[model samples]
Target: MVTANKKKIGLLMVLPAIILFIIMTIYPFAYMIYASFTDLDLSKANTGKIIGLRNYLDIFKDQLAISSIEFTALMVLIAVPVEMVLGLALSYLIRNLIGEKILRALFLIPMMVPAAVGGFGWKMLFNFIFGPVNYFLNLFGIQSIEWFGRPGSARIAVLIVEIWQWAPFVFLILYAALQALPRDILDAGKVDGAGGWKLFLHIELPLLRPIFYVTLLLRVIDVLRTFDIVYMTTYGGPGSATSTWSFYAYKVTVSYGWNIGYGSALCVILIIVSAILINTLTKVLNIGRELGLSKE
Candidate 1:
């Protein structure tokens, strides 16, 4: 009887939270899904009427949407690999350094700064007239080049800011993974004539595979949804060279057009693409585990 009463009390305690979740998260998500099938302009939000898959169909025909998708894919492909390689190398180098803790803390400063603040700071650094970048180039007899004024430069600027701000996060995760590795296995490998690159390539890397996959997955999702830096620095200007999918959706919803329904459709598409990518990565991680690559 006492156990039964405790179970009932526990259920009662969680009931309110469950109700709140349904109201706040589940309901809003369902509503958004519904809205994606309609014409929900902010001008007449209350008069939204269902238009089936028209909104979804329209997105493929939208050139800006296509461009944003391409740019976002490119950013993820380039930035994630660059960050992963740099982070792994830095973590390995710093692990054997004096004052390693202090060094780690210093590296984490970029991650600690607010995104908007970092974006604004980078914007100033990349400014055309008074920016230090242009000043340095001028000292070399190079003419002032616009960092955000041209399409290629604008894309490069976004990639630079993103890598600078987020590489520290990847480094921290990888460093922790490296530190937590089993010393017994490493000592065994060393005794078995496994040293330097041979030991790392065969043992350390296999153990770190799981953490690496997790970090890559997270960075991919983040780069896909990137908006703040682009908004602050370029505003998707110079012919939408740096507009990610999330930024494109924002432009449609609030910046350029007030088409909420279409924006919701874009959000849905983004969600779908992210889900598929995450699912595929999870499968790859599982495969790695099954092949005896991942430790735990």
Candidate 2:
């Protein structure tokens, strides 16, 4: 009776949170899905009529939207792998170094900064005339290049800012994972004439695989929804060259278009794409079972 009562009490305590989740997250998502198929223009008198898949079809027909989606994909492809590799390499190299804790705190500075602030700061550093990046290039007798002038250069500029800001985040997670690895297995490998690359590849890499699955998923999702840096630094300039999905959606909804219907549609597509990628990655990595995080 006591156990049953305690269970009931626990359920009662969690009821409010479950209700709030439905209200805040579930309902909104359901509504957004519905809105995506409607002509939900706030500016229009006749709106919210179900149109069914026209919005989805229009996404492909729109060049700017397609370009933005492509740019976002490119960013994810380039940034996630680079961050993963760079982070893992740095963590492995310095896991046993002197003042490791201090180095960790220092490394986390970029990730800790507010995204908007960091973006604006980077904008100044990349300024063509007197920015420190160009100033240093001038010192080396190289001409200062406009970071955001051309399509290709603008994309690279956004990428550099993204990689710089988020690489440390990957490093932080992997570095901790490295520190927590079982010393017994490592010692056994060393005793068995396994040293350096052999020991890491066979033993350490396997142990780190579970954590990598989590980190890569998170990093990819974050990149997919990228907005702050592009908004602050480039403003989707040089003829919308560096625009992202999130940025484009905002532009449609509020910036100039005021087409909430199309914006919602854009969001729905993004949500669908995100879901597909996440599901594929989870299955491919088998993260749940590998991490002992799933019940069945």
Worst 10 residues of 2 by lDDT: 88-97
lDDT of 1 by residue, 30-116 (tens): 988999999999866475899999999999999999989999998989988999998988888897689999999999999999988
Which model scores highest in lDDT? 2
lDDT of each: 0.91, 0.91
For model 1, the run of ten residues with the poorest summed lDDT: 287-296
Cα lDDT over the full model 2: 0.91
